[model samples]
Target: MDSLKVKAYGKINIGLDVMAKREDGYHEVRMVMQTVRIHDNIKVDKASSGDISITTNLGFIPTDKKNLVYKAAKLLMDEFAINCGVSIDLQKHIPVSAGMGGGSSDAAAILYAMNKLFKLGLSKKELMERGALIGADVPFCLMKGTALAEGIGENVTRIAPMPECCILIAKPGFSVSTKHVYEKLRLNEIQSHPDIDGIIDAIEEEDIYEMSSLMGNVLESVTVKEHPVIEDIKMAMIDNGALNSIMSGSGPSVFGIFDEPEEAEFAMNAIREMKLAKQIFLTEPHNVE
Candidate 1:
């Protein structure tokens, strides 16, 4: 095939807890991550001109070497000594730097597509390993589905997926800097961590309520302090019938699990009416086939 079109799925942190800060300045984390149905569209094609080009729908988004997708494609082209040029077009829907793993997922998707496009014969494990060179979240983004990410988010373990229910994603107009949140986090001041073990059990048992109730993110303590609106969004989600809600990643975005489709639709409409989020999406959990 000369070209390929793919979807890069977004993700939410079902639970996130920091264990310790490594000497490398990366934090050790244990989190439950779930993929959602929302995604961005990416198309990769060959260019006869023998030069790489990256383009995107958003005007401000860089299509240069600075972009993760560009880095991914460059990494493969350089490492594998591919002789042809490539053209990449990204149509983004996922919120940038919003803790939803949008850029990482796009990078992961690009790696997979390039592997096939060039007939590189890279295995899944090999793709994931190469993916880590771009970002810590790249490995998990390549893995997709439900998984446990530890050790700066690269060490991923596939786990039983949380039972499917209505998932509502709400992103405020602003973005949160992941680096800023990590820097502000004082491990000493943290009094609680998400019950990851319990969440795993709930997933295995298909207990949405139990899993939702157990959801938490220690990073919220930092992000919410700066954006009080983050907490406000969570409360709004809960008040409108979310079983439970929490901030995703180092986030200005908050997501909630609802009991049913009707409640979820109601909650989405209500949240939309409140003008609390710049973007609101009603979607369900996504798992690898």
Candidate 2:
């Protein structure tokens, strides 16, 4: 194929555990990553121009090298010794910096599309290796389903299916700086957190209650303090019939897992009525083929 359009799906952390900061300035994290049905669209077509071109609906996303999509195209071209340039048109639906892995997914989609479009014959392992250089979550996006990610997020092991349910995602107008959240983490001050092993057991047993109870993100402590609206959204979701609500990834965008579709829709309506978030998404777990 000369050109391709790919869907870059968003992700949620079913459970995230920060082991410790590595000496290399990245946190060693163990997280259960699950892809959602919501996604951003990426269109890649060969261009006459010799330079990569990018356009996005999201004003916050840069069109230059700072954007992960740009970086991915550049990386792939240089690595493969290809001279062709492509124009990337992004219809961004995923909120930026909301811990949804939007950027990472976009980059991964580009790599996957390019490999097929250009007949690069790259293996999935090679694609993941390149994705690791793009971002911590990029590698996981390559598989786009449930997996246990570890070791600064490069290591990925496909796990059992997460509960089949609906998710109500609320993203306030403000964006949380990931670096600031990590900086504010008082490593020693964190109290008893969720048991990751127990979470895995719950997943194995398909116990939503046990899984919800252990759903914790230490970064929530940092971001909720900076943005109280996150806490309010969490409470509103739970009150509106969410089985469990917690901020996804870093902050601002909190998600409530609902056992029933009606409950998720109700929580989405509650978030809309409260005007707590600028964007609200009701999505289900992606059942990857």
Candidate 3:
């Protein structure tokens, strides 16, 4: 194929816990990541000039080397001694820097597509290894679906898909720096950590309620303290009939899982009325086949 199109799905962290600061200056974390239906569309085509170029619907995203997609293409070309270039057109629907893994997913999609376009015949493991060099979340984005992520988020173990449920995601009109969140984290002062194993079991059992109740993120303490609006969004979701709600990943974006679509829609409408979320999406868990 000379060109390919792929969907880069977003993710939500059902649970996140900071274990310890690694010697490499990265924090060890344990988290359950689940892909959602929300995604960005990426189209990659071979270019003859051997010059990487990227275009996105969003103006703020960099089209140059600063963009992760460009980095992914360059990594592939340089590593494999390929003489071709690629043109990446990103139609972004996922919120940027809202803890949804938008950029990482896009990067992963490019790697996957480029491998096919160039017929590189790279194994999934090889692609994942390459992705790790780009970003911690890139490997998981390539894997997609549900998984247990640890070791600065690069080490991933595929797990059972999350139970059937409607997910309502909300992102406030601000961004949180993952670096800032981790820097501000005091692992020693953590009051409680999420029941990571329990949530895993709940997913295997297909118990949506149990899984929802177990949802937690230790980073919430740091992010919510800085921006009280995160807490407000959680409360709004719960008040509107969410089984449980928690901030996904670092900050700002919060998600509520509901057993019924009607309940999720109700919660979405209520949250919309409150104007707590700059962007709200009603979606569901996406399991990669």
lDDT of each: 0.92, 0.87, 0.93
Using lDDT, give the best candidate's number.
Answer: 3
The lDDT of model 2 is 0.87
Local lDDT at 252 for model 3: 83
Candidate 1, TM-score vs. the true structure?
A: 0.98
The residue ranges of model 3 lying beyond 4 angstroms of the native Cα positions read none
Please list the residue runs of candidate 1 whose C-alpha ends up more than 4 Å from where it truly belongs after superposition: none
If both were scored by lDDT, which would come out higher, candidate 1 or candidate 2?
Answer: 1
Q: What alpha-carbon RMSD in Å does predicted model 1 have with respect to the real structure? A: 0.8
Q: Against the correct fold, how does model 2 do in TM-score?
A: 0.97
The C-alpha stretches of model 2 lying farther than 4 A from their native spots are none
Per-residue C-alpha lDDT of model 1 across residues 88-202, encoded as one tens digit per residue: 9999999988999999999999999999999999998999999999998999889899999988999899998779888999999999899989999999999889899999899
**Would you list the rank order by lDDT, best first?**
3, 1, 2
Worst 10 residues of 3 by lDDT: 79-88
Q: What order do candidates take by TM-score, descending? A: 3, 1, 2
